[model samples]
Target: MQNLARAVLVLFGLLVLAVACIAVSIEGSEPSVPLTEEDVIGTWQGDRGARLEVTADGRARLSDASGWRCFKDGQAGVFTGEGSWIMAQHSDEGPGILVKFTVDGAPATQCSDHFAIHRADTRDGGDVWARWLGTGSKEPYRRTPTG
Candidate 1:
């Protein structure tokens, strides 16, 4: 009876050790790296009828446009308006970019998965544009980001 109990204990210990080793091995495995500009260079289509293609050369073509725009080293667009531009991120709100161009006169901000456009003149009573790229029923073109 003693020998049988000892054998069972040893088997249980071995099983526990094996499980621990497997867990450690899984944890130590390399994690996946996020896609860089190269991976995202090609055109990407969203669930809605929107498409965006980012060029490795710093040009971005949005929504099947006829041509692309040069972003000038990630700082091409200018934000302009009145009240402080704000970017709503998480629960905390952040500063928004003031775009000055006539085409993109609306103030804007880039967040994790979306960009917002706000009118600076109104200050507190401006409209808030949400980034949705028209994926669902509502036709919104607020470009969201993906990791």
Candidate 2:
């Protein structure tokens, strides 16, 4: 009985910790600057070979990126494809984007997925933009990280 009671306590503690982590991720994701469409017009890279190229004319391309709203119909290899994006607003991260993915030039069904955006608070002020990949982790694809 004592061992079971200890296990319950441990599980409860873990649950609380998970919730706290989510809260922090959402709260601290505030944008450092007022993000515009032009601000995100650059190539943002993240860990694990993820690449998001945003062009000035509302074109976007993703390579090995996640938090995707497409590929719902057992579509494979569409992760690395062309798409279009527009400036959007997220409740947690404020200014965001909706990347409407496409598979070989056709819209990939309601690909209008919302993702968070943030800017790094650096001294260099390099106008870096970060795309929040709110999957199982909080990974940011920052553009031009300079010292």
Candidate 3:
């Protein structure tokens, strides 16, 4: 009976050690790098064939031939907006880019204009991922080739 109890205690100790190692590994990971205009000035494709275009002058356009269902106000199709993007430190997720824009000629309440973009470590060949801040919808976007 004593030997069995000792074995159980040793197993519990090993489990605790494993958990600690995983925690340390996650905490020691490096943060994401900041993005610049060169990094984001291009077309990005989202889920359901949606497209977002960012221009060098800080202008942006969101277009979907079907619709942007996330908009609660039922305004869909195309939207023209302008805003600047910046690389900032996220409190929990390390470095990320914040995109702030407003739909042109739409009510302020109809649009949730903030988004977060982060570099996806799992991707190669200049692919990044983004999420809408209000609806929590995520999508992967690849840079469109430019000449």
Q: Best candidate per lDDT, number?
A: 2
Off by over 4 Å in 3: 1-24, 27-31, 65-82, 92-94, 107-112, 122-127
lDDT of 3 by residue, 1-147 (tens): 999999999999999999999999876654345556676778877765667787777666665524443344665444445456555546665444565655566546334334456664533554466655443244445556788
Checking candidate 2 for backbone clashes, the offending pairs are: none
In model 1, what is the error at residue 146, expressed in angstroms? 20
Per-model CA lDDT versus the true structure? 0.36, 0.65, 0.59
**All candidates' TM-scores?**
0.30, 0.58, 0.55
Candidate 3 overall lDDT versus native: 0.59
lDDT of 2 by residue, 19-105 (tens): 999999977664455767766777778765678788888888777764443555544332566778888887665777877766544
Candidate 1 vs candidate 3: the TM-score winner is 3
In each prediction, how many residue pairs overlap at the backbone (N, C-alpha, C within less than 3 A)?
9, 0, 0
List model 1 lDDT by residue over 1-147, tens digit each. 999999999999999999999999877642333223333344445444555444445444344322112222443232211221222222232222221111233235321122222222233433333232111122334334455
CA RMSD for every model?
A: 16.5, 9.1, 5.0
- How far residue 115's Cα lies from its native spot in candidate 2, in Å, is 3.4
